[model samples]
Target chain A: MIKAENLYFRYTEGEAETPFALNGVNLEIKEGEFVVIIGHNGSGKSTLSKLMNGIHTPTEGRIVIDGIDTSNEDQIWEIRKRAGMVFQNPDNQLVATIVEEDVAFGPENLGLPSEEIRHRVDEALDTVHMSAYKRKAPHHLSGGQKQRVAIAGILAMKPKCIIFDEPTAMLDPSGRKEVVQTIEHLNKNEKITVIHITHYMDEAIHADRVLVMDRGKIVMEGTPKQVFSKVDELRALGLDVPQVTLVSHKLKTMGYAVSDENLTVDELVAELCRLS
Target chain B: MSIIIKALTHIYDKGTPNETVALDHIDLEIASGEFVGLIGHTGSGKSTLIQQMNGLLKPTAGDIIVNNLEITKGLELPKKQRKKYAAERKKQLIEVRKKVGLVFQYPEYQLFEETVEKDIAFGPQNLGLVESHVKQRVMDAMALVGMDYETYKDKSPFELSGGQKRRVAIAGVLAMKPDVLILDEPTAGLDPQGRDEILGQLKTLHDQEQLTVIIVSHSMEDMAKIANRLIVMNQGKVVLDGTPKDVFKEIETLEAIGLAVPQISYLIRALNEKGFALPDDIITVQGAIDAIQNVLEKRAK
Candidate 1:
């Protein structure tokens, strides 16, 4: 559903030494897949997410979302409609004071019929399990609830794909769990494509594919099991392995015959029990 | 040097429709040099409780004695002499503030100085230290936060990276040389490496300087690794208080309260449920590995 070809992007005006935030990068995501991109700060993860949603046009290469070139100015809104984005801060992205009103803003901007907009708003909130908070003010909701409202706004547009740029970075642990589970549900039950960009190792564990970015390039890409197996490499890149993976790696280093293939806590424990 | 609270209660906008009972009939004490971690969901009253310790929020009822000063309720001066007593109260409040430095969440947003040196020196200067002493304190605080004074002294805080700006903000607090330090969500926007670096520095400060450190975080892993005591708050109440092991053992209760146990603790709990002989309170990766290794060794024997 998403493809990038030789994507070279830079922020520059005059007399700037460095221009390219992303340099000669190529990536592709299939439809109905959940993909997570992980990287350290300033590694072009956010820039790449923006490129996916037509927020930034590449200076050199081309980005095609469902065969629509992002450089086409006329189709930018269409691209955004198809590839919606949820940002880091819930407070900043939400535009309306009320919960249901905020969720309706996206579809309303698309000039949908009033009845259709209302239906979409209600459906989106139900999908996010936030129907009960529909009448509440956005300011009175918790961080997780607000983020879910943001997602509902995006979902109201009926986007085929949603790109989250560190959605849980600003939330508490419970809030993070709520947001992550919501995204997973959208991908599983709604058949919506998910592209999650984050620095959190645990959040990426359940993704169908994990893409590790470093220095504006795709350094590694594979299933969670495949990527997390390289414990030393991830640590060297300043990325943390999952807590379970870290424990498994330490056991292996300590001359224990533990398997390194487990990605979740349950799998790790099961493997240890079998070994015993 | 111990901080004590007895039946403390705080209500925001009291006597109004928008009143919020933030802290309710609370009681807590932290002995000198103890490291305490406070955890809760948003609006769980953790912030309100910490703000009270620094005398930023006055309790509606009950008593607070910090370093032997009665901070709760009004002072015991005569009504006619109350104005003079209020002046003295302000001075004492400043003294309490100096002894209890609070690095608010997103402390980077609080930085207002043009250069890092002046920013870190802001606290000490306010404490009326000599010019040379302020400069020394600024440098020492910078070092304590793992920032090089020579390299960052003249740089604008705005020009620094997110992590660097956060460190400079924290150095400003450390420059005050507070006996107790409370940080709320210090690692909110930081990447994993930056989070680890900040937590490591706080742990070192807690150990080497023997500073009474209170960290408010939602990350169970962070609390497990550093905190000697865990304080769990839910709905304006102190629901749980104990060592990390004791508190984390009630994983179901925490989960029900909209919190999560550390991943290691979750794993160990799962193992115990599966009829393994694992202990119930594993909170760290190293501890989990050691426990699994011991089990394996016993099986081999």
Candidate 2:
């Protein structure tokens, strides 16, 4: 539901010699597609996410969200409503002390009726499996729980897609799993579009497609299996493949008859099982 | 340089409704020249335990001895006796802090000086070192963290990249020349390359200087690569303590507590379960590759 045409963004205002944060990025995401973007720091993936939600307008080109042009000044609010964003820090996104109130904050700003806002808040909390914590304070929750609450807040706004920018970077391992699973569930069952940016390679294994960015450009794009099979290229770009993928690639290089496209442990195990 | 803890318990907001035990009755001993990895979930008392090492937070009831200096139960004396021993207590805490340097999470935010050199020189300057000695320590610390002294000394820390800013903040701690270095989530938000660079420098420093290094990290791969021992904490308790292999072998228990083993360990276990005969103890990708090659060679024979 997001489209970008020749997206170019730069931080310097008048310095033409300064490097662009995003240089010549052209992308399209169909409705309900789960896309993951991976890159090293300063790779401009975060810049791309902010552009999708209209947080940063392109300096040279344009981005259109669902038919709403992000560069248009008046439609910025409508664009944000159509595509919500959940940032890395949940504490920054949380607006209210109470959990349910924070979820209701979005609809309340949308000027919905009180009954409607309440209904949407409850439904959103239930969708994230956080109904039991509806009345608890946001600070008392774990990192994963806080992120889920932040997602619920976005859901209450009824966005067609959600952009997660390193949502698990600050969390522990289990917190990362919880947030990743929640994102997957949103895409699979809820039919919401997802654009996840992260440094964790394992989280990208199940994505519908993966985009590899480097030095402000979309260097690679393909299905998870198609992209992750090139282990050395990804490493050269300062990105990592899944551990299983790396192991399988190493075996294939050694002429072990193992499939190089294995992205998960079970798949690699099955591949080696047939070999012996 | 050695740290010994006995019956440590830390409670936040004590005697109130919000009273929560951040650290339970925990006991740990970290010898000098050892590399230790602390792993835990959010609110697992890992940070609390590290802060205790540097005397940043006092325990409610416990005894902590750092290089034979008892830090607990001294600052909490009654009002009259507390005043009587304030000077002695200050001296001991300063000595403890000098011996143990802590690089907090998001340490780059703690950088306040005007230039990179000034920021790195802050600790040594505070330690009352002479001007020439402070400059020497700053240069040495910068080199240790893989930053060039001449190139970055005059530059503002804010103008540098995220990884560079992080190195400068770490150099600020290293300038103190502590016997023990503790960092919390040093690689939290850095990219794979940045993470590798920072961990590589820590490993080198540990080897060359024989500095006691304790790092709290969530990346099991990093811990597996660098740490000689791993300590897993959960709900204010030390649930497991052993080598990376021993701790990661309890994968089920770790998962149940919101922690995870390295991804290679999962692969090895799954392969073994599927009758591939791969060794279940392998936790690194290279180790798994070697094990798989050995198994395949035997099968071909």
Candidate 3:
């Protein structure tokens, strides 16, 4: 579980008129819930991710991770353990040459026993479907494989929640699917809370809740159906919804009696059929 | 000028145990004015092929002849004349490469000059253009990429945002006025709006300047929108090359190779499978809307 109260962050530019990266934000995530945060480039999404993991403390607020305050310098390690993060670039997160070693790196640092580290590494690799690649070099793996390994590294830490900051941005379509599906599986089957930040609207289709951030604030928050139904609003914010949702909205605007709650292709098609 | 490839083969770390046949005798062509999209799984030889196209990477066993100049081959300079020959080849290669500018992925990181105007003027200045000509090119390139010349000229390259930095980096290449502009994932790290802005600029450049734009990207939506032609690579082979519709039609083939068709195509297929009888050939959201309308009209009939 994660909660933020009046979170505000600002980069110290020489000029006092520098804009805030995040300003007066409040958000809460329930345990085992899957949440996706979407926004434009300068919308403080990445800054929020860093703040959640205590990499960067909030400039003027508090973020509590599972009762551990992010501002508490002594509990920084504990907060990171509870809320692990996977970054945008696959090459950057992976710190080891071998797949299993990278996954075990976190557990090793936690000073877990050797046996426990090995066991956790294997389980994590199995969860990401990278067990066969346990001995391969990270450089030899594809972008998707490297990202899965990164997720496994986070999983080995046994975090209560994992925050992925644009994990699929650098991958090919196949790579993106592999990483997204892995995260979804961890959320659904493993019951690990997931906070995914992405620019890909289609990836948000199955999220339990979606948060739209703009200019360092939470502009919109709802279920995928609730959020994507307002396609024009998303467009006005320079954001987008899934293609099916966009088409459904277009039809409704064109005087067609299509349902607005259609987020997926199947749902949209069924809406069309019922209207006909 | 047209770009031609004949049995182009690039082998990485050749003669060693790690010899990789990156490109396996690939053949291709790009007319003077055409927009092409390259799609593939990781390590599918897409980058290898593109580098060879711009004469950046030489082929191991084949040749790429650009504008009637057989690049890096067929010129057997003797050891004594090698110095003179090398200088001549370097000058000619510069001329050839200037006509075919290649922008690597995340091109913004390539910017190094202190001012935006100087960075954009780097390529033309290197080509030994006069100061006045270079200044004209710097302003023209800035305008072409949708940047204000007077506003961004004195600004440092590092001061810009991710999207703006990328545009500035692109203008540096655009200043060269290449016949063919090949960009590798020009919108890799950009947000939706930034991606649209960059793609829009590329579309305008291709249309007005008659620039041959080849975009190497993984986004099916982007390729579907802009590229008149699409090239799909797999396992060091030109697996598919055709129009966007033609290339995206083989959904199973693409999926098998870890590539994907546009999301609209999936919607149409799902509808047909569910007995809605929607047309299966829909590729874009606009096309899907028209198809759904037709289905509704048919039901009324």
Query: All models, DockQ values?
Result: 0.76, 0.84, 0.79
Candidate 3 CAPRI assessment class: medium
Question: Tens digit of lDDT per residue, candidate 2, span B84-150?
Answer: 7667667888999998999999999999989999999888998899999999999999999999999
- How well does model 2 score by local distance difference test? 0.92
Off by over 4 Å in 1: B73-85
Candidate 3 colliding pairs, count? 0
Q: Sort all candidates by TM-score, best to worst.
A: 2, 3, 1
Query: Which segments of model 3 are wrong by more than 4 Å?
Result: A13-17, B75-89, B274-280
Best by TM-score: 2
Clashes of each: 0, 0, 0
**Residue A197 displacement (Å), model 3:** 0.4
List clashing residue pairs in candidate 2: none
Candidate maximizing DockQ: 2
* Candidate number that wins on DockQ, 2 or 3: 2
Go through the candidates in order and give each one's C-alpha lDDT: 0.90, 0.92, 0.89
- lDDT (tens digit, per residue) of candidate 1 on A1-276: 999999998877468746578988898899999999998877789999999989999988899998899999999999999999999988898888889999999898899999999999999999999999999999988899999999999999989999999999989888999999999999999999999998778999889999988888899999998999899998888888889998888888888777775778888878877877
